[model samples]
Target chain A: MGLAERRRILELQQTILPERERELADICGRAIPYAVDWDTFADDAEALSLLEYSACHRVAMALRVVCRDALGREAVREGLREVAIANVADTSAMALTFEGGVLRLRGAWGQRSAGMFGDAEIGALLSARL
Target chain B: MRILLIALLASTAWYGASRMRGASATRRALRELGHVAVPRRLADREPEERDGLALFAFGRVPGSPQYMGSTTPYAERLVVAAWTPTTRAEAADRALRTVALGVEGLTWEADAGGDAVAVGTGTYEANMARRPAWVLVRDDSARGLTFAYMAWRRDASREAALRTLERVAGSFAPALPTAEYLALARARGGVR
Candidate 1:
C-alpha cells in the first residue's frame, strides 16, 4: 500500500466503522506495509505528521491488546498524546523519520531495543508483523 | 628554587579550582538523597559516575544546575523522574507506562495511594546480560518520586541505592516552587 492508499483506509476507518478493535486491527493490518515500506521521506513535511499520528494510534492499539481494558487503553493514549504534543515536531528529541527503505526514530535513550524508535513500545509494535 | 615554588603554587591552584566544580548544592542534594562515600583517590577521573543519578528541578532560576548529570551510555542506565501534571490521574497514567515497560508485559497494579505503580523484572540470573534494574515512578503533588538502580555484579551498590531512595522518599518534603520555577516547569512538560 502507498501513502495515499493508507490515508484512504484511515479515512474509511474513521468514517465507516463504529471504532471497534477488530475492525481497527484489520485496517491497520492492511496499512502497515505501506507505512513501513517507504524510503526518502526526508522532504515531505506532511508525511512526518501522518507518520507521527499513525505511530501514536498504532501504539495505543498495541497497548489495548496487552491491557484489554478500554478505560486503561484510553488513558494510555491520553498520556502518550501529552508526551507527543509536549515534545513538538521540531524540538522533540523523538521524531519519526524514514531512511534506507524503513522508518526510523532518532534521539531515544536506554537499551538500543528500548529507545531504538524514540518510543520503545511503538518500535516493538511497528517492527513486528502484527 | 624560586621556579619550583611558583610551579607548585600553580598546580595547587588548578587542583583547588577543579574541585570547586562539585558545588555545595550538588553535595547537599546528593547527601539528602543518600550519603556519598567519596573515594580516597582524586586523580584523573570522569566527572560523573559510571552508574550515576541526579535530580533536576525544572525552572528559570540560575539556582538549578545547568548540567545535572552525564548523558553517556544512556542504555546502561535507568532514570526514574517526575513531572508535575495537573491531576493525579495523569500522573497514574505516566506511572503505568513505566510499570508496563519494566515488566515487559501487561502486568501492573497501582498502590493504595494511587500515586505509584509497582513492577518487577523477576531475576537476571537466567540471562547474565540482563542488568537487574527496577523502576518506580510516583507522583506526590509537592515532590515526585522516581526510583531506579542498576546492578551488573550483584554487589552492594544496587541495594545501597535502593535503600537511599526509600529513605529519602519516606522523609520527602518538597519546598514550594518559586513562580519562575512553576512557569518554566509548565513550559517543560516532559520528565527528565
Candidate 2:
C-alpha cells in the first residue's frame, strides 16, 4: 500500500479504538443510579472506575501509534519500551520482544493485548509471527 | 431523530458484515485454542469462583475473522468481547458492519475487580426492535447470549450472566495462542 493508503488505514484503526471505550462507557453508564443507591452495589462504582482507567491506558497507546512515522519504525519500537513505564500491565509472559519496529510480545500485556494498541489474540490465533 | 436513524442504519451494516465474516463460529468448540487456556490454568484457579464464568476474547472487539492480508498491523490482534453483542433487527445487522473493531473490550472487566458505574447503553431501534450488541456475532447462539446478558442488572441476573458466559466460552475453549504467542513461547525457552 502507498503511504497515503497506510495513513488512511492507520487513521481508521485509530478511529475504532475510541469506540471500544465508548461502548464500555455506555455499558457502565446504565447502572450508576442503582449503584449509588444500593449500599452493597458500591463495587459497581469501583469497577467502572477501573475500566475507565484501563481504557485510558489503551487510548494513550493508540495515540502513540498514530504519532509514529512509518519510516521511523525502529524509533517507534523503542518508543514501546518506554511504554513499560506507563501504567500498562505487565505483558512479559505472553510473547517475544523483537528488535524491529514491531513490539512482538516476549511478555505481552497478557490480558487481551493482541496488538500494542489492538487485540492480543490475533497475534496468537493467526500465529502472527512478529 | 434523523441522526439516530442514520446511526441505526450504520449499525445494521456492521452487524451484517460481522455475521458474514466468520465461516465457522457455531456452537463448535475450537480444539486449536486449547493451548491458550491450559487445563492446568483452569485447574490452578479455584473452581467455585471460576465456575459459571469465562472470558470472551478476540483479536479486536469487532475485528473481522477473515484473515485478511499476509500480516495485519499489530493493532488488529484480538478482541476481548466479554459478551457477544447482537441484534434481531435488520437495522442492527447493518449497524454492526459499519462500526469498526475496538481493541480494549476486555481490559476493564474482571469478575471481582474494580470501581464501575453502569452507564446507559444506546440502542439503534424504533421501540419495536432492539439489540444490545457491543460486537456482532457470527451465529445465533452468540447473539442470544449477548441479548440476555445485556439485560441483566441484579446479582442473580449477573450470576446467570456469568453462567451464560461459561457456557458460551465452553463452546470455544483452549484459547489457542496466536502466532504472536507461538513466537513468545519459542523465545522463552531460547538461550537467555
Provide the DockQ value for model 1.
0.01
- Residue B53, model 1: Cα distance from true site in angstroms: 19
lDDT of 2 at B173: 31
| lDDT, candidate 2, at B180 | 31
Identify the candidate with maximal DockQ.
2
Candidate 2: stretches off by over 4 Å? A1-64, A67-69, A84-130, B1-91, B95-166, B169-192
Please give the lDDT score at residue B131 for candidate 1: 29
Model 1 lDDT, residue B81, Cα:
38
DockQ of every candidate: 0.01, 0.02
Interface RMSDs of the predictions, in order, are 18.4, 11.2
Candidate 1 chain B lowest-lDDT run of ten = B58-67
